[model samples]
Target: MSTLNSSFGSRFGLEYLPTSFMVRMGKREMMVCRDFRKRFYAVNPIMECDTGVQAGHLEVLLFRRWLLILSKSKAH
Candidate 1:
């Protein structure tokens, strides 16, 4: 396996390591990977607007909300 330093060095055509751009990542720094299984229609490069996916997301959010409300009411 190619090390991070070697890959980056080779890309720049440099034989040795680069002193700059070398920074450590924090332990708590999370890499949040979004679920891309569902393909949503994109109106623009920044915006996605798929009716089916939107509906499903809404349905799931609503169902969870209702369940929480019901559980709280039952506990009272």
Candidate 2:
């Protein structure tokens, strides 16, 4: 995807798993997850329109050196 269409910290090549989980190297606090999710939805509009997907549910967790993103459904 083009840089303009990419999410924040895209230069790091965020790691997303098959289990609706994502890991990245950053210092993101829980309070920022909502804002982050908003930006994400903005870039990937399909997530918002797809009825079969539960894109609004996003959880951010901090585990030592990794920042984890957990969602109800897998995202490309």
Candidate 3:
């Protein structure tokens, strides 16, 4: 998993991006991508976990926004 994170970080030049990526264990395998928008379209639903139970949904949303801000800053 660290290897995957490192590779992605290197590719995007965002060292903290991979930190937002997560794997959750529940009834099935789930993953949260570093980029929130990509997760909705490109990522499989099976790789998503229900965060409502732990109130983590808000954190995820905030982190996604942060990533977007970081990307935009880098773009300019």
Candidate 4:
């Protein structure tokens, strides 16, 4: 997908979601802190749109970490 075409349209039901590339990036910025080397200094837990047919070690780690993040959705 083009970075320029970065947002979800209202036609897509997921428009309510903040998962567009830019939005994810914004959230990542709000939560993640970096050091001089741009390594993780502090960060609130967040998940990524991981893609693979089979789970790798890192995928398992992400899965476990994602489980720690609680979802408190009020939308029904």
Candidate 5:
């Protein structure tokens, strides 16, 4: 895997237009989730969306979790 795939990499999401360049994140020292969302949807550049979870896989995982909870509640 390359640097872009790692947490140390400079990956970001292009979900929407960035209203501001950077926004405060942390409570103490201060942090931000900057909108270089444009940085990802480049014509020729680095790859990978900022999201870590796969949506399809997440859906299945969530279903399984909900089923587990239901089963536990109805256990006899």
Candidate 6:
């Protein structure tokens, strides 16, 4: 499979995964990094989409080192 380049949409997706230093979207979760010129990074898991095969791109963004995951929905 081809790797995805930086894009606005994919960058937004990374927001879902908190505490992620680098993220790359793909058929399956793969290793991704901002660049080979940085230090002090955190590793996060990448979630796989349940959609069918289609053209897609991965966007890598730099998140906070102490990022926290917020609750998706409030408990009733």
Q: Which is the leading candidate under lDDT?
A: 6
lDDT measured at residue 33 in model 4 versus the true structure, 0 to 100: 17
TM-score of each: 0.18, 0.21, 0.19, 0.16, 0.15, 0.18
What is the per-residue lDDT of model 5 for residues 1-76, given as tens digits with 9 covering 90 to 100? 6321212113223224343122222321111223232233333232222323222111111211110000011111
For every model shown, the clashing-pair count is 0, 0, 1, 0, 1, 0
lDDT, each prediction: 0.23, 0.29, 0.31, 0.26, 0.22, 0.33
Candidate 6 structure lDDT:
0.33
Question: Which residue runs does candidate 1 get wrong by more than 4 Å?
Answer: 1-33, 38-43, 53-76
Ten residues in sequence with the least summed lDDT for candidate 3? 67-76
Could you give candidate 6's per-residue lDDT for residues 5-74 as a string of tens digits?
A: 4332342345455434533334233324332223354534443222211234332333422322221121
- Candidate 2: residue 58 lDDT (0-100): 41
Return the candidate ranking by lDDT, descending.
Answer: 6, 3, 2, 4, 1, 5
- Please provide, for model 3 over 17-45, each residue's C-alpha lDDT reduced to its tens digit, 9 standing for 90 to 100: 45554342332223233443344343333
Whole-model lDDT, model 4? 0.26
TM-score (C-alpha) between model 1 and the true structure:
0.18
Error of 6 at 68 (Å): 17
Better of 3 and 6 by lDDT: 6
Q: Which scores better on TM-score, 1 or 4?
A: 1
Kindly indicate the candidate among 5 and 6 with the higher lDDT: 6
lDDT of 6 at 69: 20
Off by over 4 Å in 3: 1-26, 36-59, 65-76
Model 2 TM-score, all chains together: 0.21
Judging by TM-score, tell me the better candidate of 3 and 6: 3
Ranking by TM-score: 2, 3, 6, 1, 4, 5
The alpha-carbon lDDT assigned to residue 72 of candidate 1 equals 9
Please report how far candidate 6 places residue 20 from its true position, in Å: 14
lDDT of 4 by residue, 1-76 (tens): 6343422223323334443222234322111112112224443345443222222211111322321111122222
